[model samples]
Target: MFADVRRRPGNYGLGGTFREASAFVNGCDAGNSWGLLIGFREWLALKLGCEANLTWAGLILKLADVDASLHPSGSNLSATEDERAVEVLFAELDEFLSARKGASDVGRILEKYLRQNS
Candidate 1:
C-alpha cells in the first residue's frame, strides 16, 4: 500500500524518489507523527464512507473529531502556536501508542476534547 503511494511523482515528486516514503515510514517507526498516516487514513475513510463501511469509518473518525475540536481555536491562533500545539499532540500520541497497540483509541479520546468548544 505504501509502495503504491510512493509512486505518485506529482505528490511524492520525481526527484529523491525514496526519500518521502522513507521519511514517512521512519516517522511512523518513531511511534509519532501521523501526517502521512492521517492523510492516508482520511482517504481511506472517505472511500469507506462511499462503500458504506461503517467499521472503517469508525476506526478513523477520531481524526475528524480532533480536526473539528481545533478548528475554531486555530482560526484565531498564530501559526507558531498551532505548530507547538500539534507537536504537543504528537508527543502525547507517541506516549499513548508506545503504551499500547490500540493507539487509535487514545486518538479518539483526545479528539473528543481537542475540538472547538463552540
Candidate 2:
C-alpha cells in the first residue's frame, strides 16, 4: 500500500516520492514540514469515499490517526515523533487486521472500524 502511494503521481502536493510519503505515513520526516501523513490521511479518506478498498483505507486511516496524534497541527515532526508514531501505528494495524481478516469489503469494514475505533 505504501509502495502504491509512492508510485502515484503529483505527490498529492506533499512533494518527494511516494517513498517519502511512506516515510511520512510512518511518521518520518513529516514530508517537507507539511504534515504529510495528515495530508495522506485526508487524501486516503477522500479516496475511501470513492474507490479505495476498506482494508487499505482502514490501514491508511490508522496510520494517519497515529501521525495526527503525534503532530496534530501538521507541523514539522521530529525523528523521535516519527519513531513513536510508527510504533503505535504498526501495533494498531496489527490489532485491526487480526480482528478483521474475514471482512470482504474493507470500505464497509473501514466505516465500521472508524465508528468503533473513533
Candidate 3:
C-alpha cells in the first residue's frame, strides 16, 4: 500500500487514498483471490473505531495526533501535514504488520512486499 502510494504520480490524498486502495484490493480479491481484503477492511475499520465515515485521513490524523481542521478542504494538506501523514502511515503500517496474525497468503505477500519496499 505504501509502495503503491509512493509509485503514484502526484500527492496522495488522505482518506480518499486509503478508501480507494481498500476498494482496489477488495476488487482484486473479488473471488477470495487472497482472502485478505475482507479481513484487512475489518481490521482497518476496527482500528478506525467510531468514525462516522471511517476515512484514511481521519485515521492518519488520529494516529499522527494532528488536528482535522488543518486540512479543512480534505484535499489540500499542507506540506507539514503531508510529512506528518507519511510518518503516521509508516508507523501505523509497521504496527499493523507486526501485530497481524492469521493473514491469508495474499495478505502475507502484500505485507512482505511492504516490508521489502519500505
Candidate 4:
C-alpha cells in the first residue's frame, strides 16, 4: 500500500510495472498524485518518441483541463483559457514526442512553457 511505501522510504523504486505502482500510489487518494503519474507517463512518451500512443496524450490533456477548471478561484474565462492552454500543450507534446526526442528534451520544452506561462 502507499502508506507502507511511505513508511519505508527505501522500499519503493521504479522496479515494478507502471500500472501496479500507479494504482498503489493513487490508492491513497492524495492530492495531485494522479497528476504526478500523468507527468511520469508524459516523461516516458518523450523518451519513446513515436512509439508513444496518442491516447495517453489525450488523457493527459483531459486531466490538465479538468484540474484547471476545478480550481476553486478560477472563472469561466480562466477555465476556457486553461483548457486552450492544455490543448496547445497536448499538440506540442505530440509533435515533440513524435519526433523521438528524449525525456530531457521534452523536459526542457516543458520548462520553457511553464516559465513563459508563469
Candidate 5:
C-alpha cells in the first residue's frame, strides 16, 4: 500500500509529499489493523530508544531524520524533511511488508541518525 503510494502518490490524489502521505498512512493505520501495526509501534519505540507514548507516525518521521515536535503542530516538515520522511516511512513499511516483517531496517535509519550526529 505504502509502496504504491510512494511510487505513484498522484494516483492517490496526493501531492507526492510526506505530509499527505503520512496522513494517509496514519488514517489507514487508525482505520484498519492490517496485522502490520502489531508490535510495529513498540518496535519503533525500541528502535528510537524513546518513550512509547509517541505515535508510530512521529517515531517514523524521527527515524526519517525529520525535525521533532511532531505532536505540537502535526509535523511541520519542510520540503526536504517531507521527502526524507516519505522515503524512510516506506523503507520501514517495506520491511514490515516483507517476510521478515520486522524493523531490521532500523539499523539503516540509525546510520542516518549517526551520520547526522557526527
Candidate 6:
C-alpha cells in the first residue's frame, strides 16, 4: 500500500500530499485501535537509529528537515518539501514492510528495534 503511495497517491485514496498520506496511516492505525500499527514505530525508530519518541510522521518530517511544530496535523510544507517528505515516508515504510514474512513480523521488528535503541 505504501510502496507506491508517493507516486500514485490517487490509487491509495490520498490527496497526493504527504499530509494526506500521513493522515491516512493515522486513520488506519486508529481504526484498528492502534493494534495494526503497534510495531511500526519501533521499526521506524530502528530504521532511523534513534528512540526519539517520534511518530512515523514526525520521524519522516525530521529526516526532511521539517520543524516539529509544523508536523503533519498542522503542517504547511511547500510543495517541494511535501514531495520530499512523501518520498522519505514511502521509502521508510517500504523498507519496514519489506521484512514481512508472517505472524512473527512484529516480534522480529521489535527485537531489532530494542537492539538498536538499547
Q: Compared with the true structure, what per-residue lDDT tens digits does model 1 show for residues 3-78?
A: 3443453464433222233344445556654432333333334333432233222323333233423444233334
lDDT of each: 0.37, 0.42, 0.49, 0.42, 0.68, 0.75
Ranking by TM-score: 6, 5, 3, 2, 1, 4
Best by TM-score: 6
Query: Candidate 6, which segments miss by more than 4 Å at Cα?
Result: 11-13, 31-33, 70-74
Which ten-residue region of model 5 has the weakest summed lDDT?
99-108
- Which pairs of residues have clashing backbones in candidate 1? 69-115, 69-116
User: TM-scores, in order shown?
Assistant: 0.27, 0.33, 0.44, 0.27, 0.70, 0.77
Error of 6 at 85 (Å): 0.8
Which candidate ranks first by lDDT, i.e. highest? 6
- Poorest lDDT segment (10 consecutive residues) of candidate 2: 34-43
lDDT of 2 by residue, 21-101 (tens): 444455542443643232233234443354333333244434444444434333455655544434444444444445444
Please provide, for model 5 over 1-118, each residue's C-alpha lDDT reduced to its tens digit, 9 standing for 90 to 100.
Answer: 7778899999999997766876787778778765446556655666677655767777887787765674332356677877887888788767755634345554454454455445
Winner of 4 and 6 under lDDT: 6
In angstroms, the error of model 2 at 24 is 9.5
- Backbone clash pairs for candidate 5 read none
What global local distance difference test value does model 5 have? Answer: 0.68
lDDT of 1 at 5: 42
Separate clash counts for every candidate:
2, 4, 1, 0, 0, 0
Candidate 4 off by > 4 Å? 1-19, 28-30, 54-118
lDDT of 5 at 118: 53
Per-candidate Cα RMSD to the true structure, in Å, reads 12.9, 11.2, 9.4, 13.6, 6.9, 2.5
Residue pairs with clashing backbones, model 6: none
lDDT score at residue 57, model 4, on the 0-100 scale: 34
